[model samples]
Target: MINLHWVILLPIILGTIVKLISIKTAKKIMVLFQSALLISATMIFIEVRKNGTVLENIGGWPDTIGITLRADLLASVMVLLTCFLFLAMIIFVHNKNYADHLFFFLFLSLESLIIGIFLSNDLFNIFVLIEAATLIITVLIMYKKANVAIYDGMMYLLINVVAMSFFLMGLGMLYKKIGVLDFYALETALSQVKDPQSLILPYAFMITAVSLKAALMPLFSWLPKAHGTPSAPSVVSAILSGLYVKTGIYVFLRLQIAFSPLIDTSELFVILGLITAIVGFILALAQKDIKLLLAYSTVSQIGVIMIGINLDNPMAYWGGLYHLMNHAIFKSTLFLTAGMIISEYQTRNLAEINGVFKHMPAVGVATILSILGIIGAPLFNGSISKYLIASGSSGTWIESGLILVNLGTIIVFIKYGQLLFGSSGKKETADSDILEKAVVLTLSMLCFLGGIFGSELIAILFNVKLTVDRLSYSIKILLFIGSIFLGILIYRGLFKKTNRLAFITSFELGFNEICLSITLFFAFMVAYLKLTL
Candidate 1:
């Protein structure tokens, strides 16, 4: 097996070599490199599963003294997913003429950093990885050199830089107190403290950065600009929405686990998650730009995933992880297919382009399947995850809140589903790119299979047996069907005819406002932790 450090380094090494080669040679080398990376990731995952956790210290130093690379089940799964998504992205972009050696270099560098984030066992190392990845992503976002793209890319960079400063401050505070930056060592130190208040400031600072990274509530202003920038390549948007955003969620999980012994933030996050979800869908409903719609939908889905993860139930926690994987599948497909549609139709406006079923049947079918998957249709991957999440909140107001979130999801997608119907005033043609079609259709199929085999998937991915009560599942199905109808009525009656929700689009936040939100969020976290203690 390859050394774990090599897994993080090989991509950048290969990527730089490709930049000096011809474009055609670069593509061939990339395919080979990605295949090798995927193989290595699979082996690493299997090894982790069989042996429990794998740890490697740099330069043979002790775990507490050296920067360590750790691969537990969560890290392995994330690494595996990152490699798989990168492969899909390369395949999706193969036929496009614009993808060059420099593009491949930056893309591969981002891949390496993302994998590094997943494997790093030191908080400072993870922080450095995140900052590097941000700069690379900004470059990719502005690759086309358009004015608007540059503006949005810079905005994204500035926001993250501000957020990372908070992360660095928190890291320094923790190190000052404990004299160690390693995750394991820091967790051990934090656990020994009797008073939670001592660490509350550091927790607030770090979690504020995390909240922004995760795009929760007011902090989400950066996401639509980053993910939906018209000048950014669709593959860039796909990778950003699909795999990159999950890095924050992964860190959130890891950090929360470290603090779990001293403080409980489940109730706080549950409330924040619900609010974020509602706000996400409301803004999504106001979008006309297809990419922006998908971007905002991502914010909503992140909120749903947060709710599931913080429900304080084991089933819900696992369910949230499952949904994270599922979101990557379908959202990537949606963005990839949206790019195809925009290419063919010469527009990004949802109302202006239609008849996808006739103009490009394969793309349309893939898009529809992904939509169904996202909306939690009974036979799709989302249903199983939502079911598990719902099971955790049984007979509570939170349960009803989950239903309301589902209904809002359905309504939001109902507007997006408009793309599949009506004539585009063009002749029908089959989608010709074999590689792109294959990647999209495969993901769409997985959405279906994920639902049907979700119980088994949870067992495989998490090593926990998941049993579903048939009666409860049947009732869930009924609720899903009713929600669909209600969503349709609401969409037609409220969303279709009125400008009531249009004002939501006008509620934009400037950078100063966004920074203020972060300050307030940090203050609130400190207050909450104090009260709970």
Candidate 2:
């Protein structure tokens, strides 16, 4: 029988070859093969769940020497989610005029690369897969012929490539000292070396690199430009926000396991995360463009994950990981809904676009449910993860940080939710869009039900002991209510008083990135001095 690992690679290889046939057929392959792969991903995901991690070595080589496919519970969950989002995107793209076959093909290539990244135990493999993903996405963002798309994509590529280079250099340094590039191998080397400083340079390199990808700060400049301006098919919206950005969390988890020597950086992560959360929300609140608002919101949500990583408790990791899932689910829903809104009407400014729900009631309901989910309102998916991420932090100084995150998200969504009911939800006449309605209804269901079943979902994906205390529930309720109240106050009080500014061009954007890079370099030097001679 063919190995399931081999089974997974079959389509990727076929896709590479398909382009020689016809661009039209190549584009269609994303729709065709991803459907089969989705089914296969489900079956394997279930199998991996029951039997423990699956290790598939290519060319029948042993695990340590050969390229290996390692599917742990983490990979199973992430890759399955990737496939689901990809399929949903295919449906969203079905009727649109794709610029070329490359767009369609890249979708699967990206899907496969993401699967490969999650499933690979080898660090080098992850790098290759990640680079592949970055290349594909960069090209996708600039799929059009215009300069805005081209310039934005170029900036994204340059920054990401620099980050990726730093990460590689760090890996090379680690490999030089340890002669191994796999996570398990690195763990063994880390333990045997005894010189904790053996990893100062490499550890420093990777943290900075991954932080860039994860959009932790300073490294996050590309996120707004890349994601906010993409063609943003509904499913792609879901995947980029929900699945792609979470790779940083995966890197952090792996770092914890492999670079235990550098565990001290957890505190640093916490401080930087707090900074990121506050700055990101403030920037988000300042935006006039709706996509940019959501883009800044992405920065804030990632800050939430960093808090969990920095908190570094098993429970904190649990919450961080849990929020990882929730953010991906709801943020994707919001972005996709944003795409449909743009398609139905023609504007992306929250102030300009209104009464969309009137024309497309399903989109309206989806928008409302996604808003509720994002705000962590009662019984929606966003609340569960929000509680974990918040509970993952202390209820004191840092807790206020999480509250700010909620309030910022609520600020933007309320702007949209209120708009859908007013003068903007429709044009001259309110007409029903059955196709648009169906898509929105599907996502809206996920948004609502994800919250309702969050606890069970958490248990199924992660083995951490998670308990929902009454106090936890009460705090979340209070935070949600307080955020809504504050949003209203801010809208009435400050929004009317504030002027519009683009976070993208501001000095603050560069300031955050420079601060992050300086911090990472400083941490690296200190680690080197302390660990080495």
Candidate with maximal TM-score: 1
Tens digits of lDDT, candidate 1, 168-242: 999888788778888788788888989788888888999999889999987899999999999799999999999
Q: Residues 106-173, candidate 2, lDDT per residue (tens digit)?
A: 76677778877888889888888888888888777777646777777777777777788878988899
Candidate 1's C-alpha lDDT? 0.90
Question: Once all C-alphas are superposed, what RMSD does model 2 give against the true structure?
Answer: 3.2
| Worst ten in a row by lDDT for model 2 | 503-512
- Cα displacement (angstroms), candidate 2, residue 471, comes to 4.5
- Local distance difference test values of all predictions, in order: 0.90, 0.73
